[model samples]
Target chain A: MSGNPVERLGRGTTDLVVDLGGLARFAGRVVVAGSGRPWRLRRLLDEVFGIGVLSISIIGLSGLVVGLVLGLQGYNTLVRFGAENSLGAVVGLTLIRELGPVLTALLVAGRAGSAIAAEIGSMVVTEQLDGLRMMSVDPEDFVVAPKAMAMVISMPLLSALFITLGLFGGMVVAVGIVGGDAGIYLTSLESSVEFREDVLGSLVKALVFGVLVALIATWRGYTAEPNAAGVSAATTSTVVASSVSVLIFDFFITALWRV
Target chain B: MNVSPLRDLLVGCFVLAGLLSLAYLSVTLGGLSYRGPGGLQIHATFDEVGGLKPRAPVVIGGVKVGQIKSIQLDGDLRPRAVLDVDPAVGIPVDSSASILTSGVLGDQYIGIELGAEEDVLKGGDEIQYTQSAVILERLIGKVVQNLGADSE
Candidate 1:
């Protein structure tokens, strides 16, 4: 049993190294493929529509609800300290700095990242990817590149929508419900939010999360075993990996880029 | 796959709207403006700036009339702040500049108290009367010293 445990540990380490190497090679190939003349704009738009536009309602609604909740809770706490006037600053900073990008990325990972993995996994299981290879069409370029580019373009835009709607939701709760002055809330928000720090940081986070979700989803799908169960597993793994990584990277990014 | 131009157009509009709103929010909420309301540069020297940062608002009667463009040390090693005030706001020659904390324990900004004078200060003019930032620890120490002296 002791020998078996040691061997399993060694095998796990080796698997991790091999997986990292595969991911690096896949990233390299995607970079090398580059955006050539036949820019595949149509395919890219289709992916953007599927990934960004379709996810808007879900992202926007969640942002609104979350903002309202933050305002409600913040008002209750701040009133105790007679600082209720700062509700806008609290809500705006939280949404802009942390919640907006992180929540949007998670939603996109669940909705679009899983879809990417499942679609590619299905292609792999059905041997469609192999068929493309037989036709001398590089599968990464034809299948993955456009989707990845769409994600990179769509994430920051979606995050901006989330933040904008979230601010309105916060205003509704803080001003309409909590009896705070709208002018004070707005002025405080304006004074507190910094463009170079909060806005730029949020966009940067969204961009990184977008690239990560696409890469992980595509890698899992591309390497999926040739079976129906493998496709489902790939979809599940995409959601899990993308969500966890977004959270982990958010912490590091916040620490590193703190104003 | 059938490419729908209508769908693409709608998506493009949605993205463009989002981006425009983002730009608006960053500019308005972030208090970022490029054209500085056509201002004139003025200077004030303070013994200490404390927690004051560059770009801090310059307020008069609680209204933001300008901003601190930069802070540098003069030959005497005293910190001097360069303020850019709206040309519409004419500061009298005897006006005083003071560094003040916003709220109870908030960020520091420059506050200007207008003085009555016949002559109005122009661009490149330096305000003579100035006050430095009040350090909280120093205030507490003074309070403690007063209490000790009373007990003695």
Candidate 2:
């Protein structure tokens, strides 16, 4: 019976596909339940503080490092062509479009994604999720909505913070450290770029990534089996799924934008 | 029929609102760079785009005016990059396209250096000249190797 290859293959493929379908439905249900809750205001507060308010320091520090690195690297490249003035736009545009979104998603995946998986997985193992169902209360409203809403809301502000911090970080390295003229750099960058386009793409990516991360983590945790073993799996799955999902969506969005 | 569609409808609205937040953020963040009131698209081509990704900005004079819309290999096996520029900033046809790196280890994007030519490049115009991105690490290695040879 254990060596039944045909049965194993059939079961594995069926479960994989079915799991994905079930996950999609579960995600939809989460959104619905979250919205229908009377404590929507409270949920919003938790999301903002947990996802956005608390993440400021890390996001800021990362932005500073990236910006400084960009400045240092950019100076070397531009000095060769004698077009060193292009540094600000390079830093600004890159942060707005690619690094800002990618980094933020990664950070959130680690912090929030793992947390979601752990929270839900623990709940599942303890029978809390089932208890809610038994009591006719929607767990999605009480759980999923807060996390998802927080991500969607806080991502844009975080992106902007990343951009602003990066700009300053680059400023320190370029102007203060490298002796580049700050006024000239800003003027050139302002004349050449707009904040809206750069920020818009990041906002979009973050929002989507947030939702995806929430979905994956919550699903893995909520549907986990085998108790403690399931928690470990859920945690791993949440991080892996969030990271992979971000990269996949990044590719798709990039492709679509190009079109 | 006996149950309430009203409950389902309420749930739907909540979900919709959450979705809208995502969509709204995407649109706003994407438009943060050079954008006109009404969005517009422009096109450009390059021999080598390097590692340029989509949503990569179309910058002129170190200012982003658009984004790279698509990239494909031409009949000559050259990379042809399509750009989406804001309608407001008019690019002249004789403008030069160069693949420039943001820094030592950063993403590459095509830069349009506007020419002082009397006629401005309109929509569907091609940038006459192109320069591919110059990687700093490669350049530095070459410089160091040459110096080592001199010392030897």
Candidate 3:
């Protein structure tokens, strides 16, 4: 039984190595397909409308709710120490530095990443990609590039909107509901958050998460087996894989930010 | 397939809102500004700046007229702070600058009280009188020592 477990572990490691190789090759093809002439602006707009515009309400509402919760909890904790005045700085820094980008990416991964994978998976199952190839058209250029590019364009904007709403929500809870001094809250927030360091870092994190999610989703769909079950599996894996990688990369980015 | 104009317009609005929120975050909360070097520069030396830092506000009579541009150590190893004030706000040459905290544990800032001299302070001038930051620990220690001496 012990040897059996070791054998399974060895097989799993080999499979992971092989999958990583395939993913790298697929990513190279996508970059080549996306960067060339005929910028494909129309399809990109359609994808952006699908991915970004539709995701705004969820992103905004989640941001506000999270901010409110942070304010409430932060105030309760800080009041004990008589540091309730620093609530704004705490909420603002936490949102801009970490939660805003990470939450937005996770939301996008669940909402849009699954859809991209399923749509591409269905297209593959229906042999539409084969049809496009038969017509001397590249499916990667026509289908994958626009979706990936739209994700890259939308992520930072959505993250910014999320953070803005979060700050407003936090202010509502901290000042309006709790009766903290508005001037102190605002000044504390402004003083603590630096544009060059925290704001720019948040946007960069969002952008990197965008690239990671887009590549993983597209690659999964393109390589999925041509069947209904395969399409569902691809969608599920897209959500799971992208979410994991977004969090992992967030850790790495934050650790290396000052370096 | 051609997209509808209304849809494109919605997308445009979304993009605009995103950019607007980004601008708000960067400018208001992040304290970004495009002001050039149009302010009057003056210097003050202090024994201890305490929590005073660069970009701390410089106010007179509770009205802000400037900010600390930088903080450096002078040849005497004292903290020399450079203040950037609005050129429009004239200051007297004999004015005094003091480092004061906002509350018991809030951030520290520089407050200047105007002197009675007719001559307005000019650029690169130095404030004649200055007070250093009050350390809380030292104050408490002094109070304890005074009580001890009185009991003895």
Candidate 4:
């Protein structure tokens, strides 16, 4: 605590590099150890249910609300330029290309990511991870891997649900509430959105976000200081780290895709 | 924890539904329809196609009739666009084709103007009257040149 400022800075940089290296090792172990035997189908299913099914209401509701808001705002702005009919295009493109994956990742990070960190952190505090190590059982496989796999599998599905519900919500606001022609709205949405650029791009983004969220959550939890306060801190770190990484990665991915 | 078959079933169904809906949305909303009615191809040549690309909508009187199938350079090095118009849509032989920008800063599409002719165009027919894209920069340059001349 009494070190020179430059020394402190240098120490911090070394700590960060070491942390990143350890994380990469942990992730590698999860991938390798998670693939092998006693294929835990039951555990994977439970993780999927916990991660995917439970988050549906929040994801769907937010998607619908976001879509509705987009429709309202897009209509108001487009009408001035006599391009009101293109509201569908605006809403569809926004949801599929950017909002769908990004928002779903952020929400899932808040919900599932924190839960993962907390659960694993509590287990660590209880010495369950140490017990597995003592028994020569790989904790990465038994715990982290299943959850990571579940998150990977569930993310794209959730993103699709978000986009689907969002489109319906946009339609409700645009056609039902805003007095826009339903036919035109549908047509414009169909004509403007592309399968590869928008839909696949979103799914790819979701996949990347899912991996980041799960890995960050598990990593923080696995490395927690053996205490209740440590578990809580890890959970908070999961949320903050996942959210920031999602946004930063999103910018890079979007820049790469240019969509 | 007890493994419930019902829960597994429900999870499977949910994932399946989500995937199916995604596929449906991508195909329908993305305009990747494959089982639609048959269409006929018509060719039109232009000096400059600008940013117009294949798959851009081909509209008639503000209604979409088909899409641009392909664009290739002709003998004179002009851009020739092949449009795949729906068979149901009958374009007159004397009709004109022009590249139009959707909005101020939007994508470009092909616009077909109907003509009063008894004979309707058949497949493989050429649209003789075609207008190329209007380059915004060139238009602004011309306007600026005119303004400068007036000031002098």
Each candidate's DockQ: 0.62, 0.07, 0.70, 0.52
lDDT string for model 1 (A1-259, tens) is 2568889899889999999899999988876664665677788888888888888899889989988999999899999998888888999999999999999999999999999999999999999999999999888888888888888888888888999888989999977897778888887788788888888898899999999998999999999998999999999999999999999999999999882
Segments in model 2 whose C-alpha atoms lie over 4 Å from true places: A1-12, A37-39, A194-197, B1-152
DockQ of 4: 0.52
- Would you list the clashing residue pairs of candidate 3? none
lDDT by residue (A95-198, candidate 4, tens digit) is 99999999999999999999999999999999999899999988899999999999988888999999888888999988898898888888789878877778
Q: Per-residue alpha-carbon lDDT of model 1 for B15-114, expressed as tens digits?
A: 8977886887778877676326577899999999998887789999999888888899999999999998888888999999999998886779999999
What order do candidates take by TM-score, descending? 3, 1, 4, 2
- Kindly give the stretch of ten consecutive residues in candidate 4 chain A with the minimal lDDT sum: A191-200
- The TM-score of candidate 1's chain A against the true chain A comes to 0.96
User: How well docked is model 2, in DockQ terms?
Assistant: 0.07
| Candidate 4 C-alpha error for residue B12, in Å | 1.2
lDDT of 3 by residue, B40-142 (tens): 8999999999999887889999987878888999999999999998889889888899999998888899999999999998889999899999999999999
Q: Write the per-residue lDDT of candidate 2 for residues A11-64, one digit (tens) a residue.
A: 889988999999989878877777663866655665566667667778879989
lDDT (0 to 1) per candidate: 0.88, 0.73, 0.91, 0.90
**Residue B19 lDDT, candidate 4, scale 0-100:** 90
Q: 2 or 3, which is superior by DockQ?
A: 3
Candidates in order, TM-scores: namely: 0.87, 0.62, 0.88, 0.81
lDDT of 3 by residue, A72-118 (tens): 99899999999999999999999999999999999999999999999
lDDT score of residue B47 within candidate 4:
91
- What's the iRMSD of model 3? 0.9
Error of 1 at A230 (Å): 0.6
TM-score of 2: 0.62
